[model samples]
Target chain A: MSAAELHNNEMIHGYLNDLRRYLSRLAPHETQEVIREIESHLFDVLDQQAANGQAADVAEILRGFGDARQLAALYVAHIEEGAPPPRGFRAIQSVKKSVTASLYFAMAVFGFSMAFGLLFIAGAKFLLPESVGVWSTPHGDSIVVGFVSVPPMATPEVMGWWIVPVATLLAVGVAWLTRKVLLVLKQHM
Target chain B: MNSTEALMEKWEVQLRKGTLELAILAALQQRTLYGLELLKLLQSLPSTTITEGTLYPLLDRLKRDELVDAQWVQEGETRPRKYYQLTPLGNKKLTDLTRLWRQSVSDIEWLLANPGPQPLPNTGV
Candidate 1:
């Protein structure tokens, strides 16, 4: 009703808004429950202050709750990490684990095979220079690359010695990317 | 604060953190209090004092752990307050923690009471 009371209400609302934003990670109902409890506590404290003939110092009360972000973080940490998983959550957790595991192995297999394929081509170019070559068709309609026992009849070989360095670079790049991906996946697992 | 006072404050914080759960459980024994009421009761004590920031989240955790139960109660025109009480599990926890606390206090008191003029007494060792 008073100007001061209006300002205090604004401050409380502002604090609660910030708290709600920080607590967005919680389920909607859980977030509302936390907000409601704190709101109730804040108003109760104000009433107590009024009953005692003391002016409502919203700042002092908010200080007891500390920063809204910090308070929300405490709630989030306990709810997310401290509480045990609910029933049927174990199945979901296992499924998640398996998915990560499959992704990791699949990535390793795909990436390493590609890398090894490139490396093999690069190496074979030295041993069988005639067989392993990048070739352009007579009509230049398509290009073929990789190890071939008979180099493709009448297709002029291109990239000569350049294929070795190019393939080697590609192999290194693929291997590095795979390692980075696996590292990220390992953390989730 | 000066270094000595800061050190003392740090020690007090550690002490409070260790005893906080037990203190909460003990406070709720045979009582149902809302957040503000519980906070006031805790602040009334010198050592068990805690802020709203600490209490609410800890209470949430206790409820999640099934150690405490909370209910929203409306009285007349006042806002509905979430009242908390110790569950059976919470009471059992309180009993266990109280025994541990008393034992710790007695052990420390024994050490403090006995000054080293003679060898420390050994019983059944």
Candidate 2:
């Protein structure tokens, strides 16, 4: 490539990197879309300037784009108008956004895992007969593992059939929690 | 620049910002142009001062609002160019906005031409 072409390429690359960092919250596809449009526009401008025998100063070209963050904000505002509003200061908002999203995801994954385990236990308890015992010993003591069952140490009160409905509700709660976690993941993605 | 000139410059910026959407719509009234082509045409005009950052978002807004239609067309060997044109709804909007803008400009011009009442010559009561 010619010196001018190399310089132009460097300038465009630098400007795009600045823009990408500023718009980090955007989905990969969205960021690419914006960058592609910009690259096309800049190259056309530069080519025209070159043809006219004028110097296509990269700094001048970038200035024409205005401030990088401001430009990113404009695109973000336009695209994410339907999404949640960014909070606090401009720079802080991006950091807070990613941090918050990651925290929510982590919490959701933890919640879902806990819920799944609990739901499995509850479901197993519901399926097992009330009198069923995990370990029946010759000493006339039975070890119970049911959701509502008292361990061998605790007072052995017979759990009523109503435990089925209660266990069912707990399973339903876990399912709902799973759905919510999936939604949060989808939105972040 | 002096303070008065600076103040005028500030207001001009504000005024231009407001009219840019209208200007873009007007430009697209007759023909379809790709992003760079449209930018060139607007830059050629003395009144319009726009950059890709401002123009693309506005174009995106217009597209989102269903005021403009866009398509990618490729002629052999070159990159596909995205061209934008006005939708039927956009035409209607442009016609209405143009009328309102013209009326407002005329009113402002009248106020400028005749600076009304010149302090109403000291009516001593």
Candidate 3:
């Protein structure tokens, strides 16, 4: 064979190899069938050119097939469309989507409510300083937080004016964390 | 390309895409042709010209849809070629599409023949 023919064969094989790689999603036999058909078509075109006394132009022929990846994509697209999803596959996908959506809402509710409660406590501390205080029982067996009808007897209040800043900071941190988490969940949804 | 040329090209692409299946079905009417022959036949026509990338995939789809049947035919000493022919369903589709195509052409022709400043006939309004 001539050097030009050898080079043409190499180029044809190279293009077919790339096409085969891109068609991996197809079944093995189907991939082979696609490859075989294309190879046959290529050779037929070359034979026609030879019969017409024209040189084999592998590049021009490959151009008609366009990019290997794009051609494979077209074949894959139709196969996917032809085969409907398995029974209940769509149901599972929807369930997963809803689960993410519900998780997002649940996280939003839990986080925002916690932040709101903290901010409320901070506000209440200023309005009813005497009613709301954190106290340790006499034996330190238990600690009590939030409003009380009357201040605990003989137990000193902790976080005396600093509770406002502490509660506000905690609220801000929880709110920020909630926002970030919701953003992540939203993407999945 | 100039904007006008670009717009014309886009319109042509849309027109080609819309009619491609009909064209393929019509081409295969009472005829069995392999990929290369079919591609050559289509490229010979002005509007039905398409690439190997487009033709093979579309043929695959037509086969899958039962609109066409393909078989690998091997002649003496030559490579096997997958030849395609219209199935009954494909022929039915071609007939239906031909009717619609004729209807569309006549409608456009009527509109062209009847210019503005004259009310279209057969309109109750």
Candidate 4:
């Protein structure tokens, strides 16, 4: 019989969740995936040992891996130096920070864009129908173009694409600046 | 154990501490074992014990670095266990570290064996 048969699936689920949460400080982006890999490696080894009739304690097994402080310190040193992440993990932390900033910026831009879109739609509906057709000062032709009943202010073309990229870049800059400020202030803290 | 040995256990972690990573890696080079098994093996050596929180993280770092490879296997009808083993790189690192450590020990021993502290006291009134 294997470990799955001995314990409920929920136990493993909970255990894996706990492991991910515990490792979050170090590998926030790939925490769960990293934990799963480690967990799989551990279970395989433990199972073999158990096959030899040796009793095992999961927590102790986990603990024997060694001190996280020293390990985290090494990673943090790389981060501060702006060096690549250690061998297995990539140094995508700065990327994540940039993306997170961009997301927030996008949300802000989205709210303003939506307001602009709505105002354009409403302005088109209200102002276009108030007059039969917009008359140009130089032409004698008042070319009847609208049904007046439907409003002719064709919605102002939304420049969502422009907003998205601009917002994202602005957000990334802000996030980068914020991180620098925090790092500078850490000594005082 | 002698009286000095007993005293050393309490205060010696500070003294023999810089090479702990070397110590742990050397221990792991012996076999592929899970966290607890590694801990037990390290402890079973007679005079040392390492905390669990500290050990596991270091192991994860090692695994992440590809210095070690780990796998999970079902132990019983109940739960799976994780085990670690040295990669070729890890073995090489262990071997190099061992030689360096041995050299340092010899160098330090040689230094300690030959020491002269004869300085005349300066008296200025």
What DockQ does every candidate get? 0.62, 0.50, 0.57, 0.26
Total residue pair clashes for candidate 2: 0
**Candidate scoring better on lDDT of 1 and 3:** 1
Q: TM-score each candidate.
A: 0.67, 0.61, 0.66, 0.43
Flag regions of model 1 displaced more than 4 Å: A79-189, B123-125
Best by lDDT: 1
Best by DockQ: 1
Candidate 2, B34-90: lDDT as tens digits: 988888889899788688778887897788689998887888976767799999999
Sort the candidates on DockQ, descending order: 1, 3, 2, 4
Error of 4 at B95 (Å): 1.3
True contacts kept of each: 0.96, 0.57, 0.87, 0.43
State candidate 1's DockQ.
0.62
Candidate 1 vs candidate 4: the DockQ winner is 1
How would you encode candidate 2's per-residue C-alpha lDDT over A1-189 as one tens digit per residue?
889789879978988999989887776766777788788778777777889999888778788788888998887784455754333235766786788777777877777776676566556654665543343344656545455454444445354555456555766787687778768765774
lDDT of 1: 0.93
lDDT (C-alpha) at residue A60 in model 3: 98
Docking class of 1: medium
Q: What is the lDDT of residue A80 in candidate 3?
A: 69
Model 4 bad stretches (over 4 Å): A1-22, A25-30, A33-189, B1-11, B14-17, B76-78, B115-125
lDDT of 3 by residue, A1-189 (tens): 999999999999999999999988777778898999999999999998999999899999999999999999988895466685434346768989998988999999999999999898889998999978789888989988877888889998987888889989999999999999999889899
